[model samples]
Target chain A: MNWKTVLRLVSVDVKSGRLIRGQRLRRYRERRLFQYLLYGGACVLGIVIGLGAGTLYTAVPDPDLRTLFYEGARLLFLSFPIMVLIYSLIFTMMSQIQRMGVRSSIQLPYWLPITWEEHTLASTLAHLIGVPLASIILFGSAIATVSIYLEAVPLAILTIFALVASAFLASTTTEIFRVLQARLIGAVYKSSGRAAVWVRFLGSLLFLIAFYVAWFALTSGGGSIALIEMVASAQQAGWFVPYVWLGMALASFMNGLLAQTIIFSLASLLFILVLFYVAVKLNAKFGLYEPPAITVSRGAYVPKVGFLGRLGFSSLEAAVIRKDFKAFTRRRELMYVFIMPLVFILMPLMQYSGIYGTPVTPGSSRFLSAWILLAPGAIMAVMLGTIIIGEEGGSVWLFFSSPITARSLVKCKYAFVIIFSCIVTLVCGAIGILIARPSPDIAVVLLIESMLLIFALGAVSLGTGIKGADFTEVPRPRMVRPLTVLVYGLLCLVLALAIFSPLLLHAVAMEYIPLPVSLPKLDLYVAISISAVIALVVTFVFYKIALKNAEEFLIKAEI
Target chain B: MILGLIKPDSGSVNVVCTKAEDDPVAVKRQVGYVPESPRLYDFLTGLEYLDFVGDIYGLDASEKKARIEEYLEAMELEGREGDMISSYSQGMKQKITLISAFLHKPKLLLLDEPLSSLDPRSARIVKDLLRKLTAQGITTIMSTHVLEIAQAMCDRIAIMYEGRLLALGNMKELRQKARLPGSDLEDIFLKLTGTEDVREVVEALLK
Candidate 1:
C-alpha cells in the first residue's frame, strides 16, 4: 500500500469527522455520542424482539424452517422502498453540506499533485464511511437469520442477490430525485414567472402521487398472493414472491439444475449493473452545475397586513417572525412542513379505501378524529421545534445579540405553532364532517375534542421545543428506531386521550355510549366543561414552564 | 427612485445612498462591508466559497470572479475557510470575509473592523484598500481603528468607533498638542485625549 495515498485518505476522514464533530459538539455538546449509541441499540433490540416474536408465532407441525426464512426475506424486500426514501433524504442533506463547504476538503488533493479520478474515488469512499453503519448491520442480521431458518441454499443465495439489487435501487432513486429538483429549480430561475414555477411544482407532486399509487398496488397485491400461498401450500412465500424467479433458479441449481440457475443469475446481474452504471454517470454530469444565485431587489415600501401586530407582539417579535417566514418560504426543503401535514390527513383514508374497500365506520371515525386533531401537534413538536433551532444554522447569535428578548423569540415560535395548529384543527373538523356526517351533537363533540387535542399538542410541542437539541448540520439518517417511533406514538395517544376524556364522558352520560346505562345530555355537557377547564389549566402551567426552560436552554446552548 | 434600506421617507439627509434604480445591486459590485458581527453558514467551507457578497455582486459566472485561491492567499486564510466558516477562528473569518460590498471593486468601502479581532497583517491589508481605492477616486468611510493607525492612514479621518464622532480632520491640522515637534501620531493621539497626567499614564501603559 502507498503510505501517501493512505495518509491522504486518512486526512479526508479526519476532515469530515472534524467538521461533523464540531457541529455535534456545539449543538449537542457531550450528549451526542450517547444519543447516537442509544438510537443504534434501540434499533438492534427492536429487530431481535420482532424476530423472536415471529419464531414464537410459528405453528406448523414439523415446521420447515424454510417458511420462516422466506417470511424474513419478504420483510427485507418490503424495507427496500423505505430505505430508498431515507437514502434520498441523506443525499439531499449531503448536497447541502457540500454547498456549504464540507466537501471542499477534496480540493486539497487537487492542489497536491493527486489525479482527479483517484481523489474522487477516495472522496466517495470517505463519504460512504460517514454514512451511519446501522443499515448495513441490519441488512446483515436479516440475511443471517433468514439463511439459518431456511437451511435452504437456494433461498440464501437469492436473498444475497436481492440485497445488492436494493442498494442499487436506493442509490438510483436518490439520484433521480436530485436531478429533478435541480432541473425544476433551474427552470424556475430562468423563467422568473410564477405560473411556470407553480406548474413545475404541481408536476412533481403529481409524479410522486403516481409513483406511490403504483408502489401501493404492487406491494399489496404481491402481499395478498403470498398470503394465499402460505395458506394453501403450508409454505411462506415471504421474500420468495418478490424474488420468485431467483428462488426458483437457486432451487434448480441446488437440485443439480445448472442451466436454469445460470440463466436467471446472469440476467438479474446484467440488469442491476446496467442501472448502477447509468445512475453513476448521470450523477456525475448533474453534480457539476453551481447553485443559482437569487437576487431580491427592493421594491416599493408596502406596509403589509400585520398578522403578528394583531397578536399584541412587540415590533421585535414581528420582525423575527417575518425574517423566519421569508427564510422558510425561500427554501424548497422547508416547504415540506406545509405539505407533510396534509399527507398525514390523507394516509388513513388512502390505506383503508385503496386496499380493503372498508368505508370509515363509527369506530374507525373516532380513531380518525383523534388522528386529525393530534397528528399536526406531534409533527410540529418534533419536526418544527427541531428545525427552528437547526435552521438558524450558525447565525443564532444574531437572535441572541439583538435587542429582541429571548422571550419574544420563543413567543413568536409558539405563535406559529398555535396558528398552524388551528389550521390543522379546522382541516380535521372538515374531514370529520365528511367522514362522520354525525348529528349536531357529534359536531359539537368534534369541536370540543379538536380544541382539547390542540391544547394537548401545544403542551407537548412546547416541551419538545424547549428540550430538543439542534441537529441542523447532522444529515438526517434513519435515526429513529421502531421503538422510538412506538414510544412517540404512545405518548401522542396518551395526550389525545387525556384531552378527549371529557368528551368521552359527556358522550356516555348523553346515552351516546352503546352499552351500560342511559343518562342526561346535560350531565354529559357538565363533564366535558370540567375536562375543558382542567385542560386549560394544565396548558397554561406547561406554557409557563416551557418559557422558563426554553430561556435556560437558549442561554446554555453553545451557539 | 430605487428603494434604499436606510432611506427616510420624510426627513432631510445628506448621506450618499445607492438606490436600486441606480443599479443598487451593481453599486454593491464594488463595495465591501465588515459588519458589526460576522455571521456565516456553518456548513460552508472557506475556500470553497466566494461568500454572500460575491454572489450578491453577481459574479456567478467563471472568468470574471476572483478565484477562491486568490482570496485565501490574500487574506492569508490558506486552510481555514476551506472548512466550514463555523470552524474558523473569529479573527481568521473576519479577515477573509469579503462582503459583496467589496467583491466588485467598489469605488466606496464601509468597514466596521476597528479594534476587534483583526490582526496586524490583516489590519494593514484593510488600510491599503482605502489608499488603493481612493487613488482611483473611490471614497471610504471607516469606523476608526487605533488612533495612531487611523492618524497615519487616513487623509481625512473621523474618530467615531464609539458610535459618535469625536473629531474629524487631517493629521497635521489635528496635531496641535504635539508641541515638541516631530512627535509621532501616537503622541498626537495622547494630546487629543486632553489630560497631561492621564496621557502620561496611558503612554506609560502603552510602553
Candidate 2:
C-alpha cells in the first residue's frame, strides 16, 4: 500500500532494541548507523572468508578434488534456501511471541491513517531485517563470491534469489501466526471467563513448550547442518510440499532442468503471495483488536490479614508480597518470567528422561541431578530479585506515596524472592530425585548449595535492581538497566562459584586425590558448613546494601 | 516534598510535624497523595489493590474493609470493585486512585487534578467529600487547571506560572491584587500570569 509509511514503520521496529539505551540518546542517526554496522560487518566478514576460500579453491589444481569440492558446494547451495527459511521462520516466530504483550516491539499506530496491509508488510519486513537478514547476507555473500571460482555464478545468483524469497515466505507466515495467536488467546480468555488467569497461563506455557519441543526436534541430532541435509533429501520425495519448493527450484536449476525450475519457482512464488494475502487479511481482522478483560475474582469487598503474618512479616510487607505474587500470576508480560525457570529445569529433566535420546549414566545422572537441584532455583532467584522492584514500572509511585519504609521494602521483596526460589528448588529437586535417584548425601549437598546460592544471589540482585531499576515501559518493558544486569550476573556467577568451591574441592579430594599424610581429612559436612556461613555473610552484606538502595529509590520517586 | 514523594533540592521540607528528610515514612504516614496521572497496578482487582494500599498504611482489617466499601459506593464503583483494574475505564481508575488517597484518612491530602477523568456526579461527590473532610480538620492541597473549580472549592488559591507562584490568596484578595476588582478568577489569573495578551496570539495564528 503506502511504501513510505511501511518503510518508516519498519525502521522503528528495526531499531526497537536500541530504545532501551535510555532517554538522552534517542538520536535516530546513531541508531541507524548501529543497525547498519551489524549487517555490514557480517557481510564484510562473509566476503573475506569467501575470498580466502575462493583463492584456496583455485589453487587446488587437482581435477578430482576440485570436482568433489564443487559437488559439496553445490549440495550446500541447493539446501541453503530451506535452511534460511527454517531459521527465519523460527526466529521471527520467537520474536513475535514477545511482541504479543501490550507494549510490543513496535506499537502499531492503529490510530494513524495507515492501512492494515501496510502495517502487516512493515512488520513482516522488520522481523526479517534482524537475524534472518544478517543470515542471508552472510551466507549469500560467501556463496556468491566463492561461486566465481566454482564457475557457478548463475546458480549462486538463482540460489540467492530463492534464499531471499524463502525468508520472506517464513516471515509472512510468522506474521499470520502472530495475528492468529492473539486472536486465539483472546477467544480462549473470552470463553474461559472466570478461569481466564489459569487458562491463559497454562495455555501459553503449553504453547511455549510445544514451540521449544518442535525446535529441539528440528535441530536435535547433528544440529542445523544435519537437519539441512535431511531436508535436502526430503525435498525430492516431498516436492508437493510448498515449504521445500524454493530449495527444489534451486536443485532443479542446478540439474539443468529449466522447465522444472520454472514450475517450482512459480509455485513457491504463488505460495508466498497466498501467505502474504492471508497474513494481510488476518492483520486487517484482528491487529487492532483488544482482548477482553480477564476476571480473576468477583463479588468481594473484604480485607484480611492473611497467613503471611504467621511468617513474621508486617502487614505492609505481607501486602506487598501478596500483590507481587498476584502480579506474577495474573500479568501476561510477567508470565514469561515464571515459565522460563520451569523450562530451564524441564530441559535437563527431559534429557534425563531419555526423551532427547540421551540415556542417563550414573556419572552424567549425578551431574544432571546436581544441576537440576542447584541451578534453576539460583537462576530464578537472581532473575526475580533483579526484576522485582523494576516490575513496578509506572506504578512505583504507590510505594513512594505509601508509608513503606526502606527496610520494609527490602524485607518484603527479599522474602518474596526467597520464598519463590525455595518453591522452585523443592519442585525441581523433587523431579530430579525422581528421575536420577541421587544418593541422599549428594541430594542434601545439592539442596543446601541451591538454597545458599538463592539466598546470596537474591540479595545481590535485589540490591542491584534497587540501584538501577529502569522504569521505561514504552516499546516494551525493560525491568533493569542492561549494564546493571550484566554486572549483577557476573557478580552472581562469581559468588556462586565461591560458595560452591569448597564443596567441589571436597568432592574432588574424596573421589580422586591421594590423601597427603600430613593433612587432616576434610569432612563433607564441614565444607557445606563453610558454604552456609559464606552465603549468610554475603546475604547479610547485600541485604544491607539493598536496604540502602531502597531508601534512595524511595526518596527519588519520579512522581 | 510535603508528601516525601520526592526529596526537596534546596528548601527544608516538613509534613505534619515530621521533617521529610529525617523521616520520610513518618511524613508519608501523615499525607495521602494522588499524582497528576495515576499509574496503578492493573493486575490486581480494585478491591485487592485498595486492600493492599490499606494494609501498607497499617489499616486494621475491619477498618480497611469498611473504608474501601464506603469509598467504592461513594464513587459509584461498588459493583465493579471486584474486577481487575486493567478492566476499568479511565474514569473508574481515577475514582479508585481518589479513593486510595482517601482510604487511609491521613491528616493531609495532596491531589493533582483530583477530578480529572471523573464523571460529573463523581466530581460533585468528590468536591462535597473534600469539603466535608476539610471541615473535619483534614487539610487539602489540590492543583487543577480549572479556575472555576479552584475559585469555588479552595479556601486559599495559589496561581503558579512556569513553576513559580505568581500569586497566592483567597478569591477576594486575588481580585484586588490583579487590580481588576470586578473581574472573574480566569481574567485575574491571566492578568497576574502576564498572559493577558490572548487576542494578539489568536490574531497572529489566524493571520
Candidate 3:
C-alpha cells in the first residue's frame, strides 16, 4: 500500500480546491476592504483578550477568578473533541447534500495502483475533509487559549496536542458517517419520495440532541445530582468507549497518575487505528453497493409536499420558485439560514415565557412581540430575496433563455421570497399569539405590518440582487457590494421607520427625544391610518423602482 | 442575443414569428437551444431536469409524462433517471441535455456541439432524432467544427471564418462555387475561407 502517494494526492487536491480562480479574484478584490477590517478587528480582539487574561491572572486577587479559569480550561479541553465532531460531521453532510454538477473528470485517484487499504479513504477523510476542518477549528482553539492563557503558557504543547487529536477524531467520525450514507442513500431514495431527506433529517436531529445533552450535562453543576457523579457513572458504564480513554488520559495526567495515563493513552491510540481500519473496510463496501435501476417514467419528478409548491404560479415562475425552494430544503448548509428566521420568530415567546412563565394578557408586550416577528421576517425576506437569481449556480441562462421579461422574473422571485417569509412569520405569529395570547387588535396589527414589509423588503432585495449579479460566475455572491449594501440598508431603514412612525411619534410626544418642533401626536386611530398610507406608498415606489432597475440590468447584461 | 442573454450591437434576430427584442418570453417559447456546453443544474436528476423543462414549456401534466417517458427510453436514459446528473458520464449528460431541448417541441432547435461527447451509437441516434425533428418543418441550426458531419447532415452548410460566412450552400452548390467538386467539405471550406494549404502544417504537427 502506497500510503505516501495517497497522502500526497489528498493534500494536493484539497490545497488546489482552496486556490482562488480569476472569477473569485474579482470578488476578493471587491471585498478587500471588508476583509481587511474583519482581520484587523480579530487581531485587536485577540490582543485585548491577551491583556485581559494577564491582568486577571496576575492582578486579580479574587479566589473565584482562580477557580473560574481553571474550570473553564478543563471544560474547553474536554468538550473540544465533541465540538470538532459536530462541526466536521455537519460540514461533510452539507457538502454531500450540496453535491451538484457532473463528477469531476479528475480520475487521478482511480489511476493509482492501490486499493482502499492503501490509506486512500483515511487520507481523504483526514486530509480532504479533516485538514480543512482542523484548520478552521484552529482559529477557535487559538481564541480558547486566550480564555485559558494563564495555563496555556505552561501546558501549551499538550493543549495543542489535544486540539489536534480532536481534528483526527472528527475526521474518523465523519468517515464513518460517509460510509453509512454511501451505502444507505440509494435504498432510502427508493423507499419513498424524500425518504433519504427524511432519514437524514432525523439522523441530524438525533446527533444534535446528543451533542446538546452531552454539553448540557457536562456544564450544568447544579440540581440534586452533580455533573461529576453522572460522568463517573457514565465513565464506568462506558469503560470500552474510545473517547473516554482520552478523557482518562487527560485526568490521570492532571492528577499525576503516570501508570493510568500510559494505559489510557495507549488505548486511545489503539482505537484510532481500529477506526481507520473500519473506515477503509467500509469504503470498499460503499464502492460495491450498486443502486437498483430506477425506471425513468416513475422516477422523473417527485413533487414536494411544501406549501409554496402547492400555490400554482405561472408555469415558468412556478418552476423557478420550486427549484429555489427545493435547493433550499435539500442543501444542508441552508438549514442554518432556514432555521434562523424561525428562531427569531420564537424570541418573543421565549422572552414572554421567561417573564410570566405562563400566557401573558394582551398589553404593550403584544406590540413588542409583533415587532420581534417582523424584524426577523424582514431580514429573512431580504436575504432570501437577494439570492433568487444569484443562487442559480450555472443555470442563469435558464432565465435569459426564457424570454420572460426581467420585470416579470424579478417580480416572481420577489413573490417567492415574500411567500416563504410570510409562511415563517405566520407560523411564528400563530405560536406567539397562542402563548402570549395577544388581543385581536394586536394580531390584526401584526398581520398588516408583516404583509407591508414582506412586499417592500422582497422587492428591494430582488432589485439589488439582479442589479449586481454577475451571470458568468458560479456560486454567485450571497451579498451585494458593500456600497450597494449600504444603499439597500438605508432604503430598508427608511421604510421600517415609516412603518413604525406611529410608535416613534408617540415616543417623541412622550419626550423620549427632544424634537426641534413640539409636534402634537395624533390619536392611535389617526397615527395608524397615516403609517398604513406611508407603507403603501413605500411598497409601491420600491416595487416599481426595483422592477424597472431589474429590467435595465437584464436587458444590458452581456451574458 | 437571440435568447436575450446578450444584446446585439449591429443586427437583429427574428425567429418563429417572434422578434428577439419584442418579447423574450414569446421567442423563448418557440426556441430550444443546446449550447456548446450546456450548463445543466447538476444537482437535479435526469428526470427532474426534464420535468423542469416540461414545466417551463407549460406542457400539460399527462403530455409531459408521455413525452418524458418516450424520450427517456429512446435516449436509453431509463435506468439512471433517478441518479443525480453529477454522477452522469459526459455522453449520458449530453443525452439528457438533448432530451431536455426536445421536451418543449420548439419550432426552432439550435444545437452547438451537440454530439461532442456522445458515444458512436448515441451519436447515430441523435443524428436520426435531429433528422426526424427537422422533417416536421422545424427549423434546425447546428454549429460544429467537424466538417464531415456538416457535409453529411446539413442540407445547406455555411462555412464561417472569423464570424463571417465565407460561403453558404448545399454540398453540390458549395463544391461548384469553390471549384473543388472532388474534394470534401474540408477542402471546399479551406479554399473558400482562404485558409493556407494544410499538408505541411499537418506533417509538422505529426513530427
Per-residue lDDT over A1-559 for candidate 2, one digit per residue giving the tens place of the 0 to 100 score: 8899999988877666665656555354564566588799889988997899889889998999988878888988878888888889988887767555543422355678888788888988988977789989999899889999898999989988998999999999888888887788779887887898889778777777777766765666545666767877888999888998999999899889999999999999999989998998888777766656777667655567589999899999999999999888877667777666667766766656665467777767767878889988999999999999888988988888888889899999999999999999999899878877888988988998999999999999999989879877655677889899998889999999999988877866776334343334568889899999999999999999999998888888753
Worst ten in a row by lDDT for model 1 chain A: A473-482
What i-RMS does every model get? Answer: 14.7, 1.5, 4.5
Model 2, residue A45: C-alpha shift (Å): 2.8
The DockQ ranking, best first, is: 2, 3, 1
Residue runs of model 2 more than 4 Å from their true location after superposition: A14-18, A25-32, A55-65, A103-111, A215-221, A349-360, A512-521
Q: How far is A282's C-alpha from truth in model 1 (Å)?
A: 3.3
Q: What docking class should model 2 receive?
A: medium
DockQ of each: 0.06, 0.73, 0.38
User: Chain A TM-scores, all candidates?
Assistant: 0.71, 0.92, 0.73
lDDT digits (tens) for residues B1-207 of candidate 2:
786656567888766778888888888888889999988998888888899999899999999888988888888887777677876888999999988888888899999999999999999999999999999999999999998999899999999999999999998899999999788899999999999999999999999
* lDDT of model 3 at position B109: 84
Which one is best on DockQ? 2
* Backbone clashes (count) for model 2: 0
Query: For model 3, how does the per-residue alpha-carbon lDDT over A68-87 read when each residue is reduced to its tens digit?
Result: 86666555554444444445
lDDT (Cα) of model 1: 0.52
